[model samples]
Target: RTRMGQNQTSIKKEKLDDLGNKTHFTQKQLKELNKQFRKESPSGTISQDEFNEAMNLMGVVDPFLQNLVFKVFDKSKTGTITFSDFVNGLSIMTKGTQEEKLKFAFEMYDLDESGYISKEEMTKILESFYKLIGPSDDNPLATFSGKKYDAPQQLVDEIFEQMDVSGDGKISLAEYQEGAIKNPDIIQGLKLFSES
Candidate 1:
């Protein structure tokens, strides 16, 4: 009886330790997790295949949602989004309510706060967002999605290029904020993404 009780206590102690470790996420870690979750979907340059894959991954197969997403990406009204258009659409989709989302957009894209968003600023924001959400050394994408793929670097670069308007290699906070506000779906998506 004494030996059995000791074993039970030891097991309980181990379980408690495991729970404690799992519950503690630093701010940086949480930010990274958010970023990784975002990247699971194609952001700036989403091929039709990639978009479809993202829909499947997110379990959002509703026709209405699909149409809405398609519309968002159809920036040229050309009925099909090119790689650059797809990326821009994804960035737009990540936006939220004008008032609330603008704060985050400004902070993220405004490196100089010159009342304008530059291409470099946009690229920096995208890179940071990708880094924060993309798989890290400690936490790989497979761990979260239970699937494997090539490294996310290519996708990240593609997104940055798509968002960097003016061909100047940057995007200003103002630009981001304006884009975000224009798309209500993106704002809604942002809320849902953050809550999760």
Candidate 2:
């Protein structure tokens, strides 16, 4: 796949422009990420099926999020991702600035690139999360300043309330970014990025 927005270059140039933008990544992170990437595809390229298996093995159970990730990384939309594409995608996910992270998060949630996240979309995503990590003992709640959740719906409701700045029940791109900036961890929860 062609890169999301990048000039074609060699391995050295890929490392130099690790983020696909102006942001560059550290050699150590690049080396480690590449090592991980190599384990998945010895040919230095990853197809859609292989990418799905890799994320599933990594314990990412959310299918929707996994699809979103594939799209973001597969810039060319050729159903495959090269080493350079992987590195640039990884750098943006892990080391990009907050605005970058917010944009990525918005894209993931936007679904149709409609520039707005409707209640239906939000509900679907939230249900996926609830399925992955509910309030059971295996998945205790940690939101609300460590308060336990009464129900999964409460968490979803709270997010909608805080993020729907227009009171229209739908979150616009601007509203999504503002909410993500206010709660940076929300963007980090995309699972492509590390907590650090």
Index of the highest-TM-score prediction: 2
lDDT score for candidate 1 against the true structure? 0.47
- What tens digits encode model 1's per-residue C-alpha lDDT throughout 1-196? 9999999878755644543343344435434543554575344344556666676577555434444456555557666565435434434335333454455445434555565655455445444444445545332321212233244444334433544455555455544555455534334424533343
- C-alpha RMSD of each candidate structure in angstroms: 18.9, 5.9
**Clash tally, candidates in order:** 18, 1
Q: Can you write out model 2's per-residue Cα lDDT over 130-189, one digit (the tens) per residue?
A: 676664643423253234555656766777788898899889878888886786546545
Best by lDDT: 2
Clashing residue pairs for model 2: 2-76
For model 2, the superposed segments whose C-alpha errors exceed 4 Å read 1-21, 27-44, 136-152, 183-192
Give the distance in Å from residue 157's predicted Cα in candidate 2 to where it truly belongs.
2.9
Per-candidate TM equals 0.30, 0.70
Model-by-model lDDT, in order?
0.47, 0.69
